[model samples]
Target chain A: MYIILFVKISDVGENTLIEIIQDLISSSESRPDFRRKENLILGIGDDAAVWKTESGLEISTTDTMVQGVHFSFAYSSWYDIGWRAMASNLSDIAAMGGAPLYALINIGLPIDTDVDNVKDLYKGILAVGDKYSVRIVGGDLVKSHIIFITIVIIGASSQNLMLRSEMKSGDVIAVTGSLGSSAAGLRVLSGALTNNSEMHKSIIDTHLRPTPRIIEGQILAENGIRAAMDISDGLVIDLNRLCNSSGVGAIIHTDKIPTDRRLKSDFSGEEILGWALSGGEDYELLFSGPESIVLSVIPMMPAGATIIGEVSGFNVGRVSVLDPENKPIKLNDKGWDHFKL
Target chain B: MYIILFVKISDVGENTLIEIIQDLISSSESRPDFRRKENLILGIGDDAAVWKTESGLEISTTDTMVQGVHFSFAYSSWYDIGWRAMASNLSDIAAMGGAPLYALINIGLPIDTDVDNVKDLYKGILAVGDKYSVRIVGGDLVKSHIIFITIVIIGASSQNLMLRSEMKSGDVIAVTGSLGSSAAGLRVLSGALTNNSEMHKSIIDTHLRPTPRIIEGQILAENGIRAAMDISDGLVIDLNRLCNSSGVGAIIHTDKIPTDRRLKSDFSGEEILGWALSGGEDYELLFSGPESIVLSVIPMMPAGATIIGEVSGFNVGRVSVLDPENKPIKLNDKGWDHFKL
Candidate 1:
C-alpha cells in the first residue's frame, strides 16, 4: 500500500468516502479468519447490517472518543486514536466476560481532515477488533466541528454472567497486571517525563495501545467468579463503584497493589502510588470472589494477576488503603472524573 | 416532575448526572409497556446491558446527529433532537423490514449545558423508543466541543428479509406516504415559509417528528416485496441508489409522485416539486416488486401508499423522471451529500 500525501476529505465527498470505507472493509473481510462474514445476512451497502445470532444472552456497550477532549492528534496518531477507542469499548465487553462479536462505528470528521488519516484510523480500529475476532458490520459518518469515533459493540455471554454487584464480604479483590503504566506513558508522550530510558518506551506503548483483558475476564467467569469490572477511571474510583454496587467496603494493601516497576524506579513512592490509585485508562481486569477460589484462580490467570485487597464488612460502603505498618492511608480525592478533569 | 431550570451539568458532576439518568430511565422502565425490562438480564449500571435473544438474524445500525450541522436548538427542541436522532436509526431498521428491539445512545455535551435539557432529551428518546417497544438499554457519555448524539439500534428480522439488491426489471416502484413534508417543515421552522396556517403547523410537525415506516416495511416484506429502501435523502437520489444497487433503472412519473397536498397547495409547483425530488429526511419507505404483486399488495399497505413509477431494464443503472408528456426531466444533482452540502 502506498500513501497519497495531502488528499483532503473535501476532495472526496461523503459518498466517495463511504465507498472507500466499504472497499477497505470488504477487502479486510477477505482475510482467512474473518469470522462474521459467513453469518452476516447483510453487510455494507445496506440500511443496516444483519447477522445471525444463536439463542443466548447478548451484551452491548457504546463508547465515544472526541478529539481535544478524550484525545489529541499531537500526542497520538489517527491509528492510535482508532485502536484505543476500539480497545476501550472492547474492555467493556471484557468487563462483562462476553465474547466480542460485532461493532458499529460512527465517525464524525471535519471537512478538511485528510482522507488518508481516516483510512489509517479504520485500519487501526480493525487491527484491534480483528484480534478479538470482532467484525465491523455497520456504521455512520457525518460532518462535525470536532472529530470523534463512537463504537457500539454487540457481544454474547453465558447465562452465568459476571456483574459488579455480586461481591460478598469475604471476597478477595484481585487485579490483573500492573497499573500506572498508562499514566506514565502519557507523561512520556507529553514530554513530561523526558528520560529516554527503554522503560519509558514500554510505558509509552502501554498508553498508546493498552490491551483489553478479555481472556482474563472470560477465564474468571468460567471459574465461577461473579464480580468483575475493568479499571478505567483509576483503581480507587472504579473499586469504590464495585464496592458501592455490592453494598460492601474494601481494605486494600498498598504493598500488594501492583505498581509498575519502571514507574516505581523513575518517580517518588508517593507519585507512583498516586498514579496507580488515580490514573485512568489502565484497561485492566479487577475481580472479586472467595479468597481460596481467587488464590487458586490466580495461578491459572495471565501472568501478573495479584491479590491486592479484600471485600470487608468493617465499613459498609467505603474503601481504605493500609500501609505496611497497618495504618490507614487517607486519600484526599478518589479518582479522575471527566467533568472534574 | 418539577423543573430545576438553572441547574448546569457541571453543578452535579458526571457521576451524579449519571445517577439522575439512571433514575429517569428506571422510572420510565416502571411503566407497564416497558417490554424489555423483564427480559433484560442486566441494565444501565453494569459494564454493559445484557438481554436475551433467540436464534435468528439481528439488524443493527448507528447514526450521529451533530449540533448546528444537523439541527439548530433555536428552532428544534431538545426533545426534537433526541426524537429525530432515534427516528433516523429506526428508519434503517425499517428499511431492513426489522422490528426495533433496543437502542444505545452516546451523547457528547458541553459542561455548561443545562441538566434539565439532557433529561428532556432522554425523555424524547424514550418517548419515541417506547412507541415501537424499543428499550433504552446502554450508552456512553463524553465531553465535546459541539454536542452530538450517536444512536445505535439493535433490531431483529425474520429469515426472509427485504434488500435493495432484490429489485428486478418490470418491478413496480411504490412509496409509503407523501414526500416533501419534512423539507417543507424545515422551511417553516427556518422562517422560509412565513404564512402560518394549520397546513404549515402540520408540515412543521412532520419535519420535527418524522415517523419511521416500520409497519409499512413489515407489510412489504410479508407480501414478498423484495427490494426496499427508506427515503432519508430526497426521492430521486435515494431511488437512484436503489436502482444502482439492483443493477436496474427507473422512470418515475412526475404526476404520480406523491407530494404533500398541503405543500403543493401552499407553495409554487416548482418549489414543492424540488422539495419532493431533492429535499431530504422524509423517513418513508420506497419499495419495488413485480407489478402484479405490488398492485395486489397495495390494498394491504398504509393509506398513503402510492405507485409512483416502474423499474426498467433500459439505462440499467440510472434514474430519470418523466413529465406527463413522457419527456425526460434533467436533474442538476440527485440529492444531499453530507460532505458536499
Candidate 2:
C-alpha cells in the first residue's frame, strides 16, 4: 500500500495556508507592542476586521512593490522586500504629517513559494509596523504569476494638512536629508559600482531600509509649513509634479542641494548631481513654505534641513537648476518610469 | 528622425499611465452619487487621501483576485472582473452587518494592456461603488507579469456585530438565499453545461455579479442573531468552519437546502447536492439563532431566507447532513482551493 504522508502547500490547500497565516497573526497580536492597539475591535479570522477611530480627519495611501520591478531575491532578502514595501506606504502617511494607526497588506505569490519565506516576509512587515505603532489589521493573500506586495496605511491627523497644491511663489524649498543614497545603493546592487567601503554600506542600508521622515513632516505641518511631499521619484521629477499641482515653478541651487558628500570622491560632479536630480526612491521629506516658517522649522529638523531653492512663478509647470555661476540649466532626464519600454 | 505618435502605455511610461488613471479618478469623483460622500475631506490627490469617520466601530476587510486564479480574461470581461472584485470585498462588509463607506484598490497589470479596457474596468468598479454608496478613496497601480486586483473596504456599523464564534447549540441554521447557483454558473462558463436556457443565463450572471445580502445581514444583526458569515466556500465547508469557530457541531437537513430547481432537470440529485454542499462562491449570508428569533426575522429578509438545520453538540469541529429518513450523512469535499495542485 502506498500512502501520502508529507504535505506541500498545494497538498493542504488555501484553508491550511490560511491556518498558517493565523499563527503569524496570533503571534503578532499577542506581542506587547501590538496588544496596545486598543482601537482594534477584531484583528483576523472573521468575515471582516473592526477598528475604532476618533472624530478627526483620517489619511490613507497605498503603494505596491512588484518582485522583478522593485526588488530581486538575488540582491534582497524577503525581509528587506517586506520592510521596503511597508516603508514606501508609510512614507506617504508621513508626507501627510499624520501618525499611522493601521495597515492592510495584499500579497500575491506563486504557489510554489516556500512557506517559511512567506512567514519571514510577514515578520519583516510586523517589525516595521511594531516600530511605527501601526497595527496590522487585515489583508488578503492570493496566488499570482509574480510576487508582489501591496500595502495601504490608514493614519490620522488633527492638525492642518500639508497639501502639495499649497505651495506659493517665494516659499522656501527644503529637504529633510541628503539625497542620492538610494540611487547610489541601487547602482552598487546592480553591479555598476564595485565600492565596498563603509560609506557605501550605509548607502546600501539606506536603500534597503529607507526611513520615513514622519516626525520631520509633523514638525513642518505643526510649524505652519503648508506644502510637502516625500521624495519617491527623483527631486526634479517630483518637484515638477508638486509645481504642476500648485501651479508654480521652481529654481533650485545646485550648491545648496544636500547630496551625499562621499559620492564626490568616486564620481564626477555632474554624475553626483545627476543622481540627486533624477535618481528616485530617496524616501525623504521635501517641503515648501513661507521663508520665515521654513527657516524657523529648520533648526528643529533632525538632519539639519537645508533650503535649496524657492518656489518660482516665472512659468507654471517649469523647473530649472542654478549653477555656481547662477546660470539656469534645464534637465531633460526624469526619474524612473516603470512602463517605459 | 523618428517621431513618436499614437502612444501605447508602454510607449508613454508610468507617468503618462498615471495621467490616464487621474482622468478616470476625477470622473468618478465628480459623479453625483460619489459626490454625496460628505466625509471625504481629500480624495485621490496629494500624498494621502483624507476622510472623516463618526464615532462607531468600523469594519475593514481586504480581498484579492488574481487573473488566472480567481478569474480569467477568456471568460470574464474587464467589467465583470472589476465588479466582482468590489463585490467580493463588499460581501465581507455585508457579512459583518456594516455599511461600506470607503475603498482602496491596488491593481497590477501588464504595461501592454489597453488604456480603454482599464478605464472600463474602473467604470465597473464605480458602478458597484455607486450602488453600495462606497467611495473610491485611494488606490495604487503597478506593472505585473499577470493581472490582479486587491480591494480594501472600510465600513461603519453601530449595530451589534455578528460574530462566527458566538453561535449556540439548538440555534436554527439558516441562509439568506438559494445555494449552488454560482457553482452552476461556473459550470456553464466552463463549458460543462449548455447555456441556452434562461435559468442558465441567470446562473451565469450569478457567478459574474454576486449580490451581497447586506439588508438580510443587517436584519439578522438587529434581530439579535449574533452568529453569521457569508457562504463563500459552499454550505458544508463554510458550516464546518462556523462549527469549528463556535466550538460546536451541526446537522443540516439536505431536503431543506434551497438549491436551484433548474439544476435538477439537467443534473442528478447527487451532483446538485454536491454543488450545493461543496462548490463555493455563492456570497449568500448564513446565520444561526434561536428558532423564535430566526422565524421572527424571516419575514424581514429580502430574498426569503430559509431555515435548513440546527446547531448541535454531537462533537466539536464536525458537521453532517441529514437525509429525509433522518440518517446522518458525512460530507468530505470542501470548496475551491486556489493553491490546490
**Highest DockQ model number:** 1
Instruction: Kindly list the per-residue Cα lDDT of model 2 for residues B129-155, writing each as its tens digit.
Output: 666656555566677778889888877
Deviation in Å, model 2, residue A151 alpha carbon: 0.8
Question: Considering every candidate listed, which one attains the maximal lDDT?
Answer: 1
Query: Which stretches of model 2 miss by more than 4 angstroms?
Result: A1-54, B1-54
Any idea what lDDT model 1 has? 0.76
- Judged by DockQ cut-offs, the docking class of candidate 2 is incorrect
Per-residue CA lDDT of model 2 for A32-128, tens digit only, reads: 4432434443233211222446776666788889888788988888888888898888888777777777677778877666655665686667656
Question: What lDDT tens digits, residue by residue, belong to model 1 across residues B37-59?
Answer: 23343233211122445765567
